[model samples]
Target: MKFDVLRAHQGDKWYGVGDTRDAREVEVQHLVDRGVLRKAAPDVLNKAAPPVQNKAVSAPKNKASK
Candidate 1:
């Protein structure tokens, strides 16, 4: 199951608040019950990263030409 961590926690790995993680249903339930993790919304898991912009570069002039 996918969960959004509500508080800092450490199991096999460390999980911080606002971190999203995939965990076994049983483990997720245990954390949810403890108020440390909650099921993540589908949209949250599917959020896309912002696109990178490509910039144009000019060729450097030869110093010997000066």
Candidate 2:
């Protein structure tokens, strides 16, 4: 899920708006609803990138058994 980074607090644990994850969207929206965090525009996300997809890793071969 793409949780586009909108606004960050303290440089980490960044909370933003417009998330692909529904749960996270609700969480952030809840915070906004409660007035703890303000709504963030998606302009920052437009300037940033999406997370990279996972790839398969091969295991190393051992030659000792030969």
Candidate 3:
């Protein structure tokens, strides 16, 4: 479980108790109680960032009428 949480942290993802390998509420609670995993800040997970606009070339438009 520790490994799983660490993996999720490294992957920049949130690890919820319901999404753990055991998938038991108690297990997740235990981790939180033991300080193995803590609730991540909202900004850390849902920060307002600029959208990634595509700057690639566009496809040519068809001239024929369908």
**Each prediction's Cα lDDT score?**
0.84, 0.47, 0.49
- Native-vs-model 3 lDDT? 0.49
Q: If the candidates were sorted by their TM-score against the true structure, best first, what order would they fall in? A: 1, 3, 2
| Two-way TM-score contest, 1 vs 3, winner | 1
Whole-model lDDT, candidate 1? 0.84
**Ranking of all predicted structures according to lDDT, beginning with the best and ending with the worst:** 1, 3, 2
Across 19-42, the per-residue lDDT of candidate 2 in tens digits comes to: 322235555665456544554446
lDDT of 2 at 62: 67
Expressed as tens digits, the lDDT of each residue in 40-63 for candidate 3 is: 444465467889999997766765
For this target, which candidate reaches the highest lDDT against the unseen true structure? Answer: 1
lDDT string, candidate 1, 26-53, tens digits:
8678779988998889886578987987
Clashing residue pairs, candidate 2? none
Q: What residue runs in model 3 are displaced by over 4 Å at the alpha carbon? A: 1-33, 48-50, 63-66
What local lDDT does model 1 show for residue 16?
Answer: 88
Clashes of each: 0, 0, 0
In terms of TM-score, the best-performing candidate is 1
